[model samples]
Target: MQQKQTPSALDRLKELLARAGFDWFLGALIGMILLAYLWPAPGVQEGPLSLGELANYGVSLIFFFYGLRLSPEKLQAGLSSWRLHLVVQFSTFLLFPLLALPWHALFKGGSNELLWLGTFYLAALPSTVSSSVVMVSIAGGNIPAAIFNASISSLIGIFVTPLWMGLFLSASTEGFDIWQVMGKLVLQVLLPVVLGIVLHRYWGAFAEKHRQKLRYFDQSIILLIVYTSFCESFARNMFRGYSIPDLLLLGLTMICLFFLVYGIIHLISRMLGFKREDRITALFCGSKKSLVHGTVMSKVLFPDANMVGIMLLPIMIYHALQLLAASVIAQSMARKAGVAAEGE
Candidate 1:
């Protein structure tokens, strides 16, 4: 009898890449940065910033589709899990913000105000959708609750992130009207999301059918925003006096931030008597963030803040690193659980 062939290492690599939605996000980010560095353009005339306006609509539509796909019954049930919700939200809004305060204080010098804003922005963001759900499934978390938590978290972020920025940014940043920013968000993010939810019926099947292809749309929008934002930064010479060590420190800072948030949420989940599954959901969903919201909002929220581009520097790094780190962590957890089961 012929023996069955095992998959080779390349086959395994393909599987990981497909699952991760790996693309030129980093490559695009690098290219965009280089373009910005080469053809810096702060002098571009602003004509109501239609791109930002469009991005606003895109953000809204994203959330709208999420709201559409969300089952109301599931949301109600998830809401009833008050303890779970508390642990998740506390880790997101309160815990991250509190930690950012010290991080901000330590780095609150020179042009690092943008860095502080970025730190606060992370505190303000909501849980990610795809990754959180994936991690929940990998770790055997409550899958339905993960969906509800991640979806609701994004919806909550649109409002909360802007408000949080308003409070913190008002004291330090200049030339930006907080209220105007909020208005832009409501018009762009909120309204479009509502539109998408309403129209999801028409595009739902198509969106689902070509889901892999459409994932590129998501990255395209973010990459465009990154290019534009960095171009502005380059035009304004935001990276002047910055060194390689600064980037290293920023990476270290992000690693610390990620682990600290992850640990705090895990500890609180244990204390609250969460079951194994819910605890996994709590840890993953609570600590993660949305690059979608961050990029879109940065345009409106800190439009005049040229320094904000550098602020996003660490977050962009953290975003990629988190994906890689979380993937490894989830796999390790899965294997350990299996080992324990075998041992028992």
Candidate 2:
């Protein structure tokens, strides 16, 4: 018999990182920010082929592919769980914003007002589609329901996020017109998504087959957005006032926000008498926010590229925290489920 080969140290390290939810994409995100810090000009260049313009086009394509993958059958099937859907959606849109709203007074008329706005922006955003579903599945949750809720959340956010921002953005941002913002969103985001859904019957399988490639494409666009956003901020020295301690505190705030939202969802799920799968679904889906939507929306919502980078900071921190925390929790839940099954 052939001897089993021992795993190399590098391979073991990679595995450990994967289990910890530290993937190449996350590393690439950090690299993009660093590159923007070092080289801002290229990312901020104004041209058809400029990174910013390319990223704009990529955003539409990303949503188009997303719509293409959304199976109508699954959506319809998942609709029967209306109570669960209500809990998840309400938790995502209502609970989060309410939690953050109380702090608005503390940061208003202060240097940290912008940071508070970013936090509220993160709160107003929708749950992430891919990561929420992945974590739900891992935790033995309602996979189909997770998919439906995530998809629906994205569509709702296209309109709802801007509405929420309109409440405060008009005061803070000059020339902020809600009608114009809605028009741009319809053309750039909603139209493409609708078109893709219309073509789903024809090309859905192709999109699903090459889903991995599409995911990479999505990440690439996100990286481009990050690079350009940070490039503008760096070029303008927008981050000069903020110190490392501020960033650390912001990170801690994000962690606390996640746990608070997660805990509230758990309690609500239990009160509603949800089964194991549904509670898992609500816990994972309700507490998460979409980095993809956050970056893309920032481009449209905040015309000033310099501020866009700062605005994105909260979601970025939260995104990383949710992935790491959810991964560990999901794995633990999965292990426990397996043990219970074995006992049965």
Candidate 3:
């Protein structure tokens, strides 16, 4: 009899990264950054059909499809888990901001004040829907609750994030109208989502069928936004004063922030006597922040696209770090669950 062949090391690494979503698209993210650094013209220049307008339209379309794919049944079903939902949302909006205040205090008057503001913005954003649910499922968590919490978190952020930022930004800047920003968000983000939900009755299945394609479409739009923002920053020489050590510090800060939130949520879930699956769901959903909301909202929230690149840095760093950390934790949870099931 012929022996079965084992997968090679390269194949194994590819499989791991694929499961964790560190695919070729990640390479494209890096490439977009480099493109902004090198070219920095077409994307930054003002005109019709420019990257600016395209990114704006892309943001609307992203949410439109997101709403189209959301399932009302799943959402309604998830409401019964009120305790879990309350904890996750509170952790996302309240605990995150509370934890970030010290960081702001530490960095506010320092050279890295802009980076600290980016970190604070990351705190104010919502939990990511796709990745949070994906990770919860991988970890054998409560999928329905994860879906509900993540989806609702996005909706909540449309209001809360702007409100949180306005508390600081309005005090610092003249003629900054928080109400005007809220109105713009309603037009740009909320209206499209509402339209998509209305159309979802007819197009929902079609959107689900083409989900993978649509996901790539979403990432492409985000990459375009990143490119445009960075190009503007580079053109304005806004990044000139930064050094390698600064970036390294920012990266470390992001990783620490992720773990701190993760640990706090995990401990609280245990104290509340949540079951394994609910705890896992709460931990994953509660601790994560949405890079999607961060990028799209940045456009509407910050008037200057040039400064937006700096504001986006922490969210981008947190996005990558969370994926990596959560993937490992998720895999470990899966393995343990498998072992327990087999033992039973």
Candidate 4:
């Protein structure tokens, strides 16, 4: 009988590369920037092919992987902690929108219409699936609850996001058809995922074999989306509104939002008397803002809207920063707990 070889140091290195997630996204961003600089695409207003078609047929494959990974058991288990699920969902779809209102007012009638729109988009985004679950597991959080809430959040955002765009972005949101938006999400996002998940049992081995490559593929699609979107924004001069100082202010605002939500969730968990594990889950999962949903949904939901790149800015910034900051906090907490365990 043949035996599988143990992972050597070199094998471990490759596995780590394969497992490398969000940071590759940042690299993809750099690559797209280079592409833009080397060969600028003409705008629709100006011309065509200035930006490429971006993803050809690769996106379907990305969704397929998502479906393959969502185990039936995880779905069942995630439902057990209904309370935690509620907390995370409310934090995502509820809290962020209310907060963006003031920022919208503050920036109205400005050239930064795109920036303001991006903040609104940020508010309406769904919670993430992979990164949130990964963070929850790392932080010793409630996995089932994280999975349940994150999964449901995606399903719910299909309806809620368009309603938000129409209602809140009332000026240009005229003639927005909610049903059409629903169809786009179902076709592009939800249906693709469902198809992948359904075929998981048969294709599981194939997916595992190319997992790293799939991750790279996913990142590639996102960067293309970002680049094409940003290239459009630049071509339209949507960024003319803000200076470096505005970006500084935007970063500060994001910091405040993160801590405020973190504090509020911490307080609620205490009031509800959740155990440590559940509390950890609540803190990480509830605090996240989804980048994947924001990116994909922007293309579908705002098929005709202008300045989507600037509009998606808050969530994108928040997404990367949140990962870094949460990672630091999670690590610190882990170290502290380790010391306490030693003492005990």
lDDT of each: 0.73, 0.90, 0.89, 0.72
Clash-forming residue pairs, model 2: none
Candidate 4 residue lDDT tens string, 182-285: 77667877788888778878886688788777767777777766777777766666677589988887777787888888898899899999998899888888
* RMSD, every candidate, angstroms: 2.8, 2.4, 1.6, 5.4
Q: Which 10-residue window in model 4 sums to the lowest lDDT?
A: 43-52
Q: Compared with the true structure, what per-residue lDDT tens digits does model 1 show for residues 1-344?
A: 99999977556444543465444576788887787788756323355665444554555555555545545566676776667877887787778878887666666765666666777887788877887888778767888888888877877777788788787678776766778887887786777666655666677666667666666667777777777778777777888877888778778888888898898888888888899888988988888877767777787788574765786786687777677667767766776888999999
lDDT of 3: 0.89
Model 3 TM: 0.96
Ranking by lDDT: 2, 3, 1, 4
User: Which scores better on TM-score, 3 or 4?
Assistant: 3
Stretches of candidate 1 exceeding 4 Å from the true structure: 1-14, 41-68, 71-74, 200-203, 341-344
Q: Give me the displacement of residue 199 in model 2, in angstroms.
A: 0.3
Model 3 Cα lDDT, one tens digit per residue, 230-318: 99999999888889999998999889989988998989999999999999999999999998899999989987677889999999888
Candidate closest to the true structure, highest lDDT: 2
**Lowest summed lDDT over 10 consecutive residues: which window, candidate 3?**
9-18
Q: Estimate each model's TM-score.
A: 0.88, 0.95, 0.96, 0.86
